[model samples]
Target: MTQQSAAATPMSKEMQDCVQACMACHSICEETMSSCLRMGGQAPAQIMGALMDCADITRMCADMMMRRSPLAAEMCAMCARACDLCAEACAAMPDDAQMTRCAEACHRCAESCRAMASAMM
Candidate 1:
């Protein structure tokens, strides 16, 4: 396995980091939802919601993969799309640095989820 792939394998360094990243993103999105509301008024609702959902699903996907569940791959695939959408939503607003951070986190989670899904299949 290439260093990259091997690192992300279940218990490897990549997986651990990916899990932490996913968790952080999830927490940030959740925490930022209310803050985004205060910051952006009603403008950030859709994107913030998407980000929250994406973070949640991404975390779940990672957990499932860690357990070697039969549905892990499918969950990860779905999460990849969700994270991609979240990134796009966040990208729509470049002015918000927090959204940018959320976007980057979602992108990283999506990449790792995609790899995990592929490996499962």
Candidate 2:
């Protein structure tokens, strides 16, 4: 088959960076969730919800982009929103080192996802 006929296209640098950011965000979210759970009643339910949503969305977004799915752009947009919410939630507990780190990761991922979504438009 000719190169043009292949199902997959090469990923641009922006997409690659976004994918990396998504994966990183996913990892941090997972870690933060565990930390929250270990903190007993210290972490609020809202924060836990945001972390869960961000983790799931970021993982799915990265997978979609890596596979060059037609819906990858939409996924990225959703991922960005999730990341933003997660970041805001994490920022609520500035005293916690894990929360601070997770917030930073979420912010970076959100920025990258936003850029990727715009570029795909």
Candidate 3:
């Protein structure tokens, strides 16, 4: 398809919501990572890794959706998985407010991305 045509095509509501969720999740992951760093040795390596992965994937997924990339659906699927993992990691630290907030964002993003991926299929 031509770039013009692709640009002219409007995104479905689901895709838009997924993009927003991904962006939100990305922001929260970054914030959570900062919070974890301030905690020093309290945060585990695994949780940090999960937060990093989620932050990167969520940003990329949102970009893909915004650009209407042909691989957006695949990215959404991957994003959902990443979000789920991140959420689980964050949930492990339930006592931390930042972690809890990040977990909630990840959960919402995961749900939105899952819906978008399935709808695209």
The most accurate candidate by lDDT is 3
Indicate the residue-level lDDT of 92 in model 3.
97
Q: Per-residue lDDT tens digits of candidate 1, residues 1-121?
A: 6645644655757656656666766776666576777765654668867977886786787676566566767887888788888888988888878778878877887887777668767
Q: Per-residue alpha-carbon lDDT of model 2 for 7-84, expressed as tens digits?
A: 366788888899999999999999999887777857899999999999999999999888777788889999999999
> What is the lDDT of every predicted structure here?
0.74, 0.91, 0.92
Candidate 1 stretches with Cα past 4 Å from truth are 1-10
lDDT of 3 by residue, 1-121 (tens): 8766876799888888899999999999999888877778578999999999999999999999888888888999999999999999999999988999999999999999999988877
What are the clashing pairs of model 3? none
- Report the error of model 3 at residue 28, Å: 0.4
Better of 1 and 2 by TM-score: 2
State in Å the error of residue 68, model 2. Answer: 0.6
* Ranking of candidates on lDDT, top first: 3, 2, 1
- Name the lDDT of candidate 3: 0.92
Q: For model 1, what is the C-alpha lDDT against the true structure?
A: 0.74
